[model samples]
Target: MEPSKSSDDKQVAPPRRVSFKYRSGPAALRCLSDGLVYFAKPSEFNDCLEAKFDHSSVADYIERMDRSIRSVSEQRSCAGGYAVPEGDLASFEAKTACDDVNFLEATQRVGIYSTASRPDNQPMWTYYSDNSKGFCFELEWPDTVLGRYQIAPVGVLYSSAARVHNRADIFDTLIREEAELHPDWSMDQILEETRSEFFRFRFQMLNTCRAVSIKHSDWSHEHEVRFVTPRAGPLPIMGQILKRVYFVRTDFPEWGPVMMLLHQLYPTVELAKMSFQHVEPYVRVQGMTKKLVPVHE
Candidate 1:
């Protein structure tokens, strides 16, 4: 199936055909043996504001709130020939507050497996690869298992400011206008229809690909790509997709075990040593132990 397009119908193009994953020695060993990678919850990440929703368009939220209140008021006025109850008004206010809180909290369920477009990034090795004591795996993504899980790697969008999720931007007035198209429908019918459409719109708008693919500009150096899923756990990886392993430190305590495991489990995988230079480009990969197969070949 084709990827679900956004309102603008655009997709995040991969920087290159291949992406890289940085892992500690133990994590690399585990992944090499089990052919699985962990998809961590957004909250588990170093970012304190991971998956936090900032729906700060007060005017838009109030506009929708007023429409809801008016709908209830009209219904109550018709039903008992009296004013809407104070309790019901309070309930509406409470529900609005709850929705905001729930949106922010629900990000815990989001699963993210982060990758980078470039393998040569210095900080990537320092921060993610146990300060270059671990290793990095260069893999071809969109493999069978990931595709089966409907997980696609999307390029992350970097912004100088926090991503502000405006409710008005997502659940646009199109649905309301669509409901208005049905002039013959009663207010009750319209309300029911609008509520149903609203939920459907929310589901489409709250997509993992679109919602979590954004980050603060501070992370721009990572050139990050992410395989996002609704659930967090060990995601299966097909063996053949792991093309190469680049080890930064031969002195890593488990180097022997890691090398042995790689040789046994992935004999055809090219092994390379990465080095740091004092020149302009600090990080470089050279001297592969195993010959790299030409892609076209």
Candidate 2:
């Protein structure tokens, strides 16, 4: 009735722990997330999926599961922010009038409006990073135009999801290419170069933009969506630049399994569970609302 020595030894062995460390650069993180298991990173996502499902019919199951998850609306009002008033004829008309007058172009327009009307006291820069040395891009959707939106720089962190094949080479290529593009450079050359490429690519993507709008009778909403492209065209060059310094994760097949694990690890991680299957991999989450809300607490 006594247990064998082999069984006793097996029972005494410790269970392996899955540990993930944060990377310093964006490209490094992207590589790690893209199924490259170097440096103690999790790799072999397909194997992980197989282990989880215990079946070969992962494709069909995934397709069905994705559809179901996508069906669930992740829309919620941004935290500490009021919904921009809708259906107010007077306020709508006033905003239209203000926009029509090119008020933003005038030097004293915001000041003039502040004196004449109540200013919106909402914190405009919720996720500003002083280190980034640039501003986040804000895209405002127009209610009248089903899927129309305007893109503008807000404070200092722009949201994007771009994939790159190689990190170091790409970064070097971009720096050299940008430098050649702008010969007259000085101390602020690096900052200007990066920003120029970012905006240029962004506009290119915008030009070929296709709107991914969602609508519901329960809650109606629509917004324009586009990838931030490189100025050189729909090429990977700009994507590399963005991936190097910015926080972005490339769309990879392995991402599905990795995300599934992350979801299981933290069930209350909102929007983190949502997979960008066929569409652009990047979807901006409101900075204030990304905090994990505990299900039990």
Candidate 3:
């Protein structure tokens, strides 16, 4: 009898199974037969997770993978080095040595900063050695919602004993001799006239005695000071105020102590009133260009 149209449509297809070859290495195959741990299976004797090698020749590849994993783990753990306590400047200063005595020792003895501050919201402190290199410490604040954070080195301070005495003598002599020579010029006028000289002298003294020097020169005597940057070129300014006030404060209380404060202070009283503006559109364009361009070595 002939089959019906329904029977023809109901014809069955053969079953299909997907399979892959399992090639064993000499070491792994040997281990499998000897009841030893295979690379693909968990070992009964040890709790450690290890790649079972089929051959001893693949030991180098296993070692390389192990090293790479350990390196990545270590880097993640050391993402933030250390944190600074949140408190008044005085309290923070007191704990300077405690948080890391090793850092203090290195700074004082070898002129190096080993430990860095964790980045935090509270005003962070960064230690600088040789006035150029800086190490930041993170700070923790109790009142903020963010909890704690890190900050980079934004300022520096220095002190020197010899600078104090020398400055005193030089200023005294200049006042005496200049007053006698230019009696017509008032004390204020003389100071205004020789401001550049005073700045140069101060800079030289600091360079000789201190490890680091702030990057500013005084041209108070000149009608205008030129401000230059690598990317921005020269900055505009008013007359008779040629140089920016770079040094915040300096103190020479006695022969042994000479304190200098260096910081990213806000502009002086004059610049505060000027209409300083930034072009956000230009900045955005620059940022986009940087992102899209692929840098080549």
lDDT of 1 by residue, 168-249 (tens): 4444344455445776655566556656856655444344455677788888999998887667888767385688888878
- Model 3 residue 251 lDDT score: 23
Relative to the true structure, how large is the alpha-carbon lDDT of every model?
Answer: 0.69, 0.26, 0.24
Model 2: lDDT to the true structure: 0.26
Ranking by TM-score: 1, 3, 2
lDDT of 2 by residue, 12-115 (tens): 54542111122223323343345221211112211231111112132333344333322221211111211233466567456545542432122111110000
Tens-digit per-residue lDDT, 1-297, candidate 3: 111223124668664211111111232123223322111112221213111111111233234434443343343442211123344545654553253343222222211111112111111111121121111111121222111211111122222222111222233344445556775655455446446775555433332222221112231111111111112111121111111111111121210111011011112211100111266332110100001235799
TM-score of every model versus the real structure: 0.64, 0.14, 0.15
Question: Which candidate gets the maximum TM-score versus the true structure?
Answer: 1
Better model by TM-score, 1 or 2? 1
Off by over 4 Å in 1: 1-16, 56-106, 167-206, 238-240, 280-283, 290-297
Q: How many residue pairs clash in each candidate?
A: 0, 6, 17
* 195: Cα error in model 3, Å: 2.1
Every model: Cα RMSD to truth: 10.5, 27.2, 36.1
Scored by lDDT, the top model is 1
Model 1 gets an lDDT of 0.69
* Lowest-sum lDDT 10-residue window in model 2: 110-119
